[model samples]
Target chain A: MTNWQEDIVLDCSGLNCPLPVLKTKKIMDGLDSGQVLKMISTDPGSVNDVAAWAKRTGNELLETVADAGEYTHFLKKRH
Target chain B: MVETAGKKKRMALIASKGTLDWAYPPFILASTGAAMEMEVGVFFTFYGLTLLKKEISPKVSPHSNPAMPMKMPFGPDGFQQIEWPIPNILTGNMPGFETVATSLMKQTFQKKGVATIEELRDICIESDVRLIGCQMTMDVFGFSKDDFIDEVDIGGAATFLEFAAEADIQMFI
Candidate 1:
């Protein structure tokens, strides 16, 4: 994981496909450009979903870590 | 090409099934598309029109439809743990079995923390996803404008096709 400080943290554990990315998008919309958000998810689908979400939303995915079936993603708002 | 260059990304989705299990795809995809700044439109055709109705909660029961897959939150191990055969005959024959099965499925969804159908519909509305009911199906089914939710619009196949033509992604669910 990157050392960048997170402006906000969203925990989407126990949620299934679409919820993690959907929740992330909702939270990211409120963030200003360059602000970072850390997302925690337990759904395996999120591994791909978060990456695609960041790309589609024009955000920067700074880091992604998977540990003990839990995934953590760090994203920076672009616009 | 240049005329469409500045336009926003768009998606057109067709919902053709009315089963509760089938209901998730169109709304989920629409909400996700909307979140990614895409203009999303969902066309509810045939039985799918039931989903647009006000105060009507459609249901799915594996007991009634043998082809319908049972989704348990516990994964493959959940099946092995139960050690039950496919199409449990007892459950299928029981009185009010559909109601029981539907409730069980709803409970599974809750345990998984997934959004409910109603919540997902609201999400679509909040995200500005357009919901269009098929005019032909509505007529055949004897449905009126008052049958659908306030956010729904009634349209024909041609109207949906017009939206589909401009969309970057098209899905039939």
Candidate 2:
């Protein structure tokens, strides 16, 4: 776990594929290095989509939790 | 691309069909872009006009692509991964797979409270997102000037190309 595992929260509930990922990208672009973004989404594809964006955009997925059918993806932008 | 308060993104939605799957990327991007206040436009060509047609636009489905997608037994919207010979069709005139996918999306968005086709068109209009109907394609497809929604601006390939080229961000979906 990284230090950023506890900081930003982006609740993208009711959003579907691509929007969540696209919104995640926008957030990551705004934050500084080491800042974290926690994305809350109801889209089932977000797990794969966020992971793919992280891999492609050089961000890091610190952790992921799925509870009560909601998915929360934790990501730390790589410097 | 025209400048906005935040970031400016120029997107080119090459809407080729009116299928639900095909309709999505454009609508999502347009709505999301406008929601973010970005200047966006979608150029509808071929069968994509159904998105604006009031009489039967809601009923529009694929007349070609067989591999169009919808919700699956255990996955999300348009997330199912299957391959076909073409993006919107396989081998015949049958709507086949794309129908299921598009229909499901309509249902999903309705459930999720996103705008309907008409509402989306209104949003695009109010948001200043350009909705251009392909003039050449319309001619090629035998669509008259009266065949489109009132919001669409008719333009030929040269016009669209010029407009698309001037955009800071462009995408052909």
Candidate 3:
């Protein structure tokens, strides 16, 4: 519904690999656990980078969607 | 660029022997910062510069400190099943352990098609993340300016300390 962790939009446009996760950590820090963080990234590798980071960092991968020319995903801080 | 107001974002990858875990933190954090739109810098000193060395590691060390970041604990057949330096001081405690992790990371990235450190370095420059090589460490390690990857500025603890002071996130790997 409203304020899902991913709903907090963090548009990481030009940033590549490790940055997406790093950025996600920064944004997530401001929110409570169970809240979602939505990320909009242009880097192709971000698809896997974020996924791997979420797993490594103990975050939740609520969703990962790929649009025409972009990748979007939601990460919920579980820890 | 969107302003990350009140964002407690800062990092210094203070690396000593440049082992597996040590190498990843700074860059991983640095890249993470750029992604988060936070200011990031990498201060490579001592053996830590080994990660940024022109040549990356080839494979995991089957010998010393064999356990390392511990292969992520995949399964019985996975690399983590092996032994590594647990609770041991990273530097010199397990010689060659850092080397193994460094190279294995590179190989993993290469296998995964992740961006190389050199590539990440380029992105760091564009994102305004400072990439500084420790002058003192370089000298002691007998590393010439040429030995390091390009586009790194030379500085010592003071230089990095300034960053660490302002940085909300700092890691000594």
Best by lDDT: 1
Ranked by TM-score, the better of candidates 1 and 3 is: 1
Identify the superior model by lDDT, candidate 1 or candidate 3. Answer: 1
By DockQ, the best candidate is: 1
Candidate 3 chain B has its poorest 10 consecutive residues by lDDT at B1-10
Q: Which of 1 and 2 is the better model by DockQ? A: 1
Per-candidate iRMS values, in order, are 4.4, 7.7, 9.1
lDDT of candidate 1 at residue B12, scale 0 to 100: 96
Superposition-based RMSD of candidate 2 using all C-alpha atoms, in angstroms:
7.9
User: What DockQ would you assign to candidate 1?
Assistant: 0.54
Where model 1 places Cα greater than 4 Å from the true spot, the runs are: B1-5, B67-80, B86-93
Q: Which candidate number has the best TM-score?
A: 1
Native interface contacts retained, candidate 1: 0.63
Name model 2 segments beyond 4 Å from true: A1-79, B1-7, B56-105, B108-115
Residue B37 in model 3: lDDT: 49
Worst 10 residues of 3 chain A by lDDT: A1-10
Each model's lDDT comes to 0.86, 0.66, 0.67
In candidate 3, position B127 carries an lDDT of: 64
Off by over 4 Å in 3: A1-79, B1-8, B19-21, B55-59, B68-114
